[model samples]
Target: MSTLTERIDIQVKSRHELDEQLEAAVRELQEAALHVRARGILITRRLPGRYTAELSDHVPFGMTRELLR
Candidate 1:
């Protein structure tokens, strides 16, 4: 049978491991946030005409191009 001290030690070790894992998860989240922020910045800077050009390439069979403009 495990003594009280041993049980306490085991619990402490488990808690420490959990804390480390939590820290790692937090770091990953922070990195992902930075990536998302960078992508948002890029999206905000897109040329306004780019959307029309992309849409023009995929116009439906019968849709008049003038309608879009």
Candidate 2:
């Protein structure tokens, strides 16, 4: 079990773009196929044209954290 706390912010014009980038980021992070058990993607938008995407720090193994709407 491992924990990933680092966050990456994405700036896009629309939610669709954000979603696309967010999934890409997640895929990029897990691209190595290191068996990161707690692989989770958290998406948050508290500012305009900016979205936060990060691997959830407390996600249970074999499950992903729910997106923060």
Candidate 3:
């Protein structure tokens, strides 16, 4: 039997350019206010609820409270 491993590669132009790239990425997320998670080069998205509210709407207050744990 053989096992397969998955890997992702991320390429950037320069270290100093990282801030600019992050800013652009944040702007994109804020414009839609969706959850964004990145691992290596893989990016995942979590959509918001149907109700129009602030980012807090997506997460329950109790969940946020427990997150302090």
Give the alpha-carbon lDDT of every model. Answer: 0.27, 0.62, 0.30
Off by over 4 Å in 3: 1-10, 34-69
lDDT of 3 at 39: 14
Native-referenced Cα lDDT, model 2: 0.62
On a 0 to 1 TM-score scale, where does candidate 2 land against the true structure? 0.56
Q: Predict model 3's lDDT versus the native.
A: 0.30
Candidate achieving the largest TM-score: 2
| Model 2 regions lying over 4 Å from their true place | 1-5, 32-39, 66-69
> Model 1's lDDT to the true fold?
0.27
Residue 68, model 1: lDDT of 20
RMSD to true structure for each model, in Å: 24.6, 4.6, 14.8
- Assess every candidate by TM-score: 0.33, 0.56, 0.32
- State the lDDT of candidate 2 residue by residue for 1-69, as single tens digits: 765435778899988987798788667545422356555556677577777766665654334354545
Candidate 2 worst ten-residue window by lDDT: 60-69
Q: What tens digits encode model 3's per-residue C-alpha lDDT throughout 1-69?
A: 632222212235565554455445434434443233221222222222111112234443222111110
lDDT: the better of candidates 1 and 2: 2
RMSD value for candidate 2: 4.6
Candidate 3 worst ten-residue window by lDDT:
44-53
